[model samples]
Target: MKKIILSISFIFTFVICFAAIVADLTGTWKGLIKFGDQKLELTYKLKAEGEKLTGSIVSSYGEIPLTDGKIAGSDFSYKIDIGGGPQESKGKFMGDSIQITSTFGGNSVTNTFKRVAEK
Candidate 1:
């Protein structure tokens, strides 16, 4: 069953690669969000262990904890309740940056965050 063995090997390799991508998401990122004419800067401190992602978002308002966070390959989703109920955010990791989009009250805001280097 050479074909069967090859198939299994391929599947195993893919899983390992996918896990690596998810694991690489641990770091700090910064971005700016615009609400009409006002722009607010935000920072994300993230930690990834397996498929679970735990992080906090720091903004001018305050720091908000990330909830129901999951990382699948290069994509992730997290929920945050910033006084106005819970809003779900979805994002994709791109090289040195990530693009996250969240919807609130039928309006969607997307922020592109660059990786923050550790000092």
Candidate 2:
């Protein structure tokens, strides 16, 4: 009986931790990507509701609404259409930072984003 109780407690703790990890993704994150010799800054304003994620990717060009966003544990994925085509990005949410890999035209680039503190 004691073993069973301990196991149940462990499972409950794991479930709560898993949920909180995903929930922590909400807020602003900033990163930079380089195109040849030029570097462009990217900002993400993310909101997570359960497994559904909604956000906007802002840059000097303009703000692009994120689509088809999903989150599970510390992993997330989202899509953006920039007229040329729909670009999909997959990332892992690390504490205080996130690493994202985006593919376009048969090329992939990975960028690391740091979480921005709210004012």
Candidate 3:
């Protein structure tokens, strides 16, 4: 009985920690991507409400709507369709930094983004 109670408590603690890790990703993050000599600026806006998550991405070209977005534990995946061409991205949510892998034209880039400060 005592062992079972301890196991339940441990499970509860793990669940809370998992939720908190994903919740920390609720904000804007900015970073730069370098391709040899060219550097591009990237921005991500993520919002979480209850168990639902939504967000968008803005770059120099334009804004892309993130669809079918969901977060589980500290992992997240989202989809974006650019003019009918579909793309999928997955990333790990860190406390202060987020690393996402995205593919374009058969090329993929993984970027690290730091959380933007709220002003």
lDDT of each: 0.92, 0.94, 0.87
Clashes of each: 0, 0, 0
Best by TM-score: 2
What would the per-residue lDDT of candidate 3 be over residues 35-66, giving only the tens digit for each residue? 88999898999987545568999999999878
Query: CA shift at 10, candidate 3, in angstroms?
Result: 0.7
TM-score rank order: 2, 1, 3
Residue-wise lDDT of candidate 1 within 7-89, one digit each (tens)?
99999999998877876789999989999999999999999888899999998888999999998889999999978888999
Give the total clashing residue pairs for model 1: 0
Clashing pairs in 2: none
Ordered list by lDDT, greatest first: 2, 1, 3
Candidate 2, residues 1-119, lDDT tens digits: the string is: 99999999999999999889878999999999998899999999999999999999999999999999999889999999989878999999998999999998889999999999999
Least accurate 10 contiguous residues by lDDT in model 3: 47-56
Looking at candidate 3, what is the lDDT of residue 118? 91
